[model samples]
Target: MVKRTAEQRVLLDQIKQIADGLGQTLAPFCEVVVHDLLEPEQSILAIHNNLSGRAVGDPTTELGQARITDPDYPQVLANYANQFADGRQAKSTSIGIKDASGNYIAALCMNVDLTLFRSLQMAMGQFVQTATDGPKETLDPAGTDALRDRIDAFAARLATTPRALKTEERRALLGELKASGLLDVRRAMETVAAHLGVSRAAVYSYVR
Candidate 1:
């Protein structure tokens, strides 16, 4: 193992703390690693939330190797597709760290396992699955339910029941219904009066 300079050692230690904190915060689902680029043969300095089953002192990854070869390699490679050796899919982000001279000295990487999210998506799909070819029916063919729903919503907005609406409120509602052509529906006056707990003549009076 190559000996690290004091500055390099401090930087790597700080990155290990970050990896540990991130690993705990995102626990059981994400893996966080810090690699010491100076020692490519045993690059991995730390690994947290070990999803990929890798260990400290493991060799550098292809990405780390690339950074070792080129100082100008992308500093941030985000949300790329990756997979564990066991074939679990992953979403990965890698950030290359540099020393004062701009030489890539270390790397911080995160790998998020997609297995749980994929399982959740499939379970939800099954939970909400329904027969698309079944006979379709219009339960409210005449839109009476819609009209009743509107009345109930309006009354709810006023913090009252339809049957408890004051006379003026009923008049205003009747005027709105007339303007919307709901009053032209067959037996609409009867429906409105019944919902308002009043006589059909009362509904006519309000509309007039």
Candidate 2:
């Protein structure tokens, strides 16, 4: 496993704090992971901080290979990092800080139970309702924080779309499987397909 940076340690503490304070507010059972860089081509991930456990079968995520390699790709992770650094948000609901080059500086994400949030939203009880409908948020705090602004904006775009996963995200998932010694490509595709509600073909399309 790779060691986190000095600044990243700060983010790690924040992750623990958030997990303690608002972890329940999250959907459920969904662990949040944070990374600094997405080296999809090389299957390398630079994790800054994460609350998601590395228990029996957990590996880091490296799901940005395809899009990261494409210069014209719409949702490249590097692009988001740059935009966030420039104080401009990207399209997805990514909750973290990234350098101009897409290296994660600081971030906070919660493992959420989609079903519960949906049910709670349907009930429309005391949950705070924004102009948007969902409750997922991205935060880039101070203290050695390297992530730029607009990360929240990128995360918002991610939240609005139903199937808007980026190459980095897919690559991240693949890395997780590989590191766990469970890199059965075919099985991985099937499992990811089931989780994303996409077809095995789509999973292969991104991962391959």
TM-score of each: 0.63, 0.28
lDDT (10s digit) by residue, model 1, range 1-208: 6787788888988999999899999998999999999999998988999999889889999999999999999999999999999999999999999988899999999999999999999999999998999998865437577678878988998999999999999999988888988877767887888889999999999988
Query: Model 2 TM-score?
Result: 0.28
Off by over 4 Å in 1: 1-3, 130-208
The lDDT, on a scale of 0 to 1, for candidate 2 is 0.42
lDDT of 2 by residue, 1-208 (tens): 3466666556556655664555344324344444333322222122222223333123323333323344333332321221123343222223544435555444333333344445777888655556666776655223111111122233355573224556676565545545654444334445556545678787666656
Instruction: Assess candidate 1 and give its lDDT.
Output: 0.91
Q: List per-prediction Cα lDDT, in the order shown.
A: 0.91, 0.42
RMSD in Å for model 2: 28.4
lDDT, candidate 1, at 17: 94
Pairs with steric clashes in candidate 1: none
Ten residues in sequence with the least summed lDDT for candidate 1: 138-147
